[model samples]
Target chain A: MKHQFGDRRRLLQLSIAAIGFASASLALFIFMVTGTALIVVWVGVPVVVETVVKVRWLAELHRRRVGELLGEPIESPYLRRTEGNLLDQVRGLLRDPATWRDTVWLIANGTLGLALACVAVCEAVLDLLFWWLPPGLAMRAYARLSRALLAPSEKSRLALRVEQLTESRAETVDTQAAELRRIERDLHDGAQARLVALGMNLALAEDELARNPGAAKALLSEAREASSNALAELRDLVRGIHPPVLADRGLVGAVQALSLVGPVPVEVHSDLIGRLPAPVESAAYFAVAEGLANAIKHSGAHHMSITLSLENDLLSMVVRDDGTGGADPSRGTGLRGIARRLSAFDGALEVSSPPGGPTELAMVLPCASSLPKTLPSYGTA
Target chain B: MRVVLAEDLALLRDGLIRLLEANDCEVVEAVDNGPSLLRALTTHRPDIAVVDVRLPPTFTDEGLRAAIEARAQVKGLPVLVLSQYVEQLYARELLADRSGGVGYLLKDRVFNVAQFIDAVRQVAAGGTAMDPEVVAQLLTRRSGDKPLASLTPREREVLEAMAEGRSNAAIATRMFVTEKAVSKHTNSIFSKLDLPPSEDDNRRVLAVLAYLNG
Candidate 1:
């Protein structure tokens, strides 16, 4: 029932657009033939403006419909160029593709709209003129003709919209699936494979323990080293997915935990006293973790500090390291991931790592409305 | 010696139990999570407890918390925490109580079975066995401290070795210096840090640990 109603509404919209286009074109034709510059200046400009506005409105409608149907977030930024002078504004409008496309669509719509109007009028006239015959038969024939004329065009337009939406969704899903596969491949090839090899080494070492004590000892030592390496790799892989500490203790605890492990001295100050929404906490935790990792790996200086606070309902974190600086977002995937994570939360990441000292990484995330009121107590336990 | 073992992984737990048992220590209780670990300490009253920093059901600092709680409850009951990562935070938390019987080492240390066992023994005997990594982190953090800067490079090494609870002889051996020279460095470190010259090794260790742990 809802679907039928939506179809009917679309049909009404198409009919209105057809009528508006026909009227605008006829007015333009009349002004052109009479060579009335004043009429052209007044009527032509309004008609052109109205047509452009209508097309833009339709485009926005289409975009919103696609978002709703596909259940995905798609942002289209409409560039609104404003200039100080009228001449500059006019130049900007002329350069805009939206304006040109709208003009072209309007000209095409004008021709089709006139043809549609003529058919509608002719059908009505025939029905009235044939009133002397059986009224029901004549009316039914006219209705059939109108339906045949409109069905194909309406169906084509509907199909075009659906096709565009489907193509966009397919692209999104494909990208997401590809990312998942990449992560799975990384784990399987990197850590899981290493662990399997280590296990086999352990088995071989066990068999040779008594028969070849000297060789067995060496094999045992190799197996031990392999196992340790594999364990470290597995830990890294797990951390990439979700650090267990972050999930268990929330963002503050997670950052504190990271500070404890780093080679440099770290001081942590947090005002996020309570548990935040899981996704927000996760992003914040990883952002800080990545920052700390970068500081430790690249920075030569020793002291590091992390601060988390809620400012004006937004969760903000700043990680600073007093080290030889020059950290760049473009140089590493870690900082890029941090940017992406913050963006997902409608947040922003700002980095300031000038040469010769103190690198600072800052991130802000919109706080989830469902955060707990009080901070959870944290200690060794 | 009776010991309680707290580790999440079944295979590692079993292996550690077997190893400790072979070393003539009785494994009185084996618990996989933090709460159970604390409960086991109360019930078993083991002479020592070996814990993993990560434990079941959230796996972040649960074992560390349990170890701290257990120490508070049972006076002089030694605790050793093994962690996959070297975290200066955990080290500081362990040393916060100003106790002499705590140990924190990276889990990788387990591969060197003899040294790991020796550390456990040291902790059980009411002496600290801190990881070199933890000491390094502490020193790095304390680089800004005036007292730390006052020490010469050799004196810094002596202080670090002292913070690890090494004897003057061990420090000399490690640094390849004469024991007399190690003694001189220790005296210089003590004087620079304004610590009273104490004859007792344990007292000297406690004083140094207090300064480093700060």
Candidate 2:
């Protein structure tokens, strides 16, 4: 009873949301029935579609509020709603398991959500002030019930995880293919062209040698320069393919070198003790670099901080910048690239950036690191 | 011209030495890695340092870093960075020093002996020589602001030529136009890019490049 009122603010907020959920579910049920009955008329289609979407929205809100009250997160196991024309989106929604799950939640949340809200208020008022009866049993029960009913079933949750893995794998392949094409294009426009020009220069030099020594020498030197340019282009292409520094110095060193070279000042702190797997290190390096690059280019930020830690067998990074915020992962390829790279490592990235100021990007990767073979070292650079 | 060379490959280093020697430029020292290159640069304090972008002992940007560090230690240290490719990012770093004695040229540019020599000489004499490829990259980067987009194609080409540290006469010769016409296009480029007008080619190149870089 005493514990129920300890977090009174959350109880009250959730009570209101529960009430909202109950009312919204009732309205949804009515709309659903009316639309079904009037299905013969084409007007019912849009109403039914809108009802489904709203039902999901309400359930999502209820889930969040309940989860907050419980002091843990309850994930919505909904697949992303497809974006398309109305009819297509309607058809897509109809076929979605989450849509049906949400509809069921809507019906249940209507009655149970209302009862839970009323019980919470009654129990709190009766017990907190008067100590007439123990409070919060109903509210606690409702919170647990919401987690049970609103969240995805184990099977569906696994299915969604598999689907996400498949999609990310496909993206990884596509990103690789796109990268290869870019390299190919770069080579075509850069070294290949220079080599061809060099060949022509050499051919001219050989022919002109008999007639004009000075001009022939000039052409010969030109040929040499062209060959040098071709070599330089190839070197750059190889560097782009794999930064040699990453191979030499490991992630920490590579990232430090990157920040040192960046236009903006970047501070790095690390509790990461040892080298990570090569692939993970590469992905993390690139992700950090991209974050830093975006801040330098668009954020107009004066200062940036990167923190790396390996605790509880989890490698986590927080990239924070004092800049014009509003970074949307969906808006640009940079953040999306970071997310995709992280997905491969079973890592996660969270971005919180409001319009007025500082942007914070937090990335968590489930990884384990071994102690360095040579020595134990630690620092904040 | 006295120069120090930093390249990872022995074959290429020897070839570069031969090429420079043929052009009346002395290669005071030729080292294959970063530390030696830096040591040579400081020891010789030559008229110029021709450095590769990649070198031994952590080859990624080794020579570029050496160049930057060298310039930091010795102001206006003339460095003609030779790379297989050129990036605007690298160009920006090279030109970060306002007192210009910088050049970044693609290795293929070395094939055009006269132009390559001209770039080396230009850098040696405290001028800027940026790669045309890098210049193109800078020019083609789409800016939301209409300033760059506002230029006519002709003016953009002139601007590219100018960014490569070309004089009005050289731009005219390349475009097969009168120097006066090139001058007019440059004026348009300068105004369109919102830069103060100038006859000094290196200063104009730096201004236009710094803007394009942004």
Candidate 3:
């Protein structure tokens, strides 16, 4: 009885969907024809592009509806619109085979599709009147037809992969540039200025040495103090760039060093025996650092724990804190920055923070085992 | 005192040679790379070897690896490792063998020539000289440990000074207290940390370091 009721509901839904599809198909057919006719005057380029976009929208609606009926989601096959002037966008749209398939689908749905939709509507009506007729067979067949046209092809899947790589590459370049700019600003405002002051102090001290010993000694001390400050600033800047510990000791050791200085105690656990690629280690280190920083600043927690492990070719790291939760990646640039940094290396970040308690941030990255690895013996007793 | 100095840059190497010579310590051999440093250490058997952390040909802890290997070859070889930065991990590794003659210091510490020479002399006399930064990290890392937690604030300061391989007199001078007061603080810290009482200062330092490394 439940199955029958479900089928009846599905049949009614299909009937309404078919009516909508029929009207939309007719409207799209008229637009395509008018736009094609005006193309000789060149005023219809945008019109044709706009019509193709509308057709894709119409096709997407049917795809979702039919996919729901079939219990399988249909993948979108359209190429992402490339960024450029109007001509490039138009050319890209026209170059895609899926656009042509969508055009053909629009035409076929206008005629044969109209007929199938009408059949569906009639079958739904007949089922209500005569309870012996099968409720949703016609709707199932229409869904299959739409699926055949709208489902993603192998070529489109490759195109989707290329789209993803291109986006991540661009983001990585931007992140590097921003990092370089930050280093430059730090040097300019910090060590560089201090060094200049140190030099000036030394020069004045040298001149005063012949005149008075006490003033010269004071100036020399001032110069020494400036130089020390400069060194400290530069050390910090270098650590920010690439921690020397990360180079000397691998990721786990570096994180152990990081945990030592934080306000709250952080317990670190790891089973990683060999070093990962430097970039992967660096990314994981910064991600954990950001996670710890966030927890310390906002979580109001007393203790945190970091766990790292390697299995197969994947590296997994988790930073868990026992604190009041509610960490939103969209709301915090720290989390988003970690995401962007990881995405560059085909890595992912997952945050699970419920409202009341322990927040866990897990990161996973594929570290190919074929790369040469240094077995860092952190035999620190 | 005789020394084998290994630093990559020519200017700093020359500066270090002059500094040591001015302090009445002879630099027996000065080399720029890891292999040469190891060779110098083995052949000269100098009183001490001052090595950089980064050196050619690999340039990534090559000097440190060479120093470790040299120590393995020549037991109790005093090595003073210097770098722009310091790590508690590296410090612990250097001290893992528990050989008394070892030191790890930041390159910046050379600016204070008297204290730097003092550290070198201390390490040469079969003692330890850890950078204050590394010692501070040791103190903080073990803050949660039970023994360290029970330390009074004054005792904790004395412990940090001791972990940096300072003698009681040096620590007392720095803390602006008498040597007697510093020794009292050290005794209190040893009792609190449950360390076996020893007359030798280096043993006290090594015990404090081992406890902190936990």
- Model 3 compared with the native: what TM-score? 0.84
Candidate 3 reaches a DockQ of: 0.30
TM-score of 1: 0.62
Residues A280-313, candidate 2: write the lDDT tens digits.
Answer: 6778888888888877777888888999888887
TM-score of structure candidate 2? 0.55
For candidate 3, give the lDDT.
0.84
lDDT of 3 at A187: 96
Provide the DockQ value for model 2: 0.09
Q: DockQ: which is higher, 1 or 3? A: 3
lDDT of model 3 at position B153: 83
Candidate scoring better on lDDT of 1 and 3: 3
Which residue ranges in model 2 land beyond 4 Å of their true spot? A1-48, A83-91, A106-132, A166-174, A259-274, A298-307, A318-362, A366-381, B1-214
Compose the digit string of candidate 1's lDDT tens values, residues A1-381: 556445444434444443554566555444333432433455544344344445555445533543443345333323354455544554555555445544443444356546665554444445345544322232233223323332224334554455555655565466458878977998788767877877787788788887888887887788788777776776666677777667566888778877765567789998777777666777688778887887888888678899999977799999898998898998877788677666655677898999997889988888766445333333332
Going through the candidates in order, their DockQ values are 0.27, 0.09, 0.30
Q: Chain A structural similarity (TM-score) per candidate?
A: 0.47, 0.73, 0.82
Docking class of 3: acceptable
TM-score of each: 0.62, 0.55, 0.84
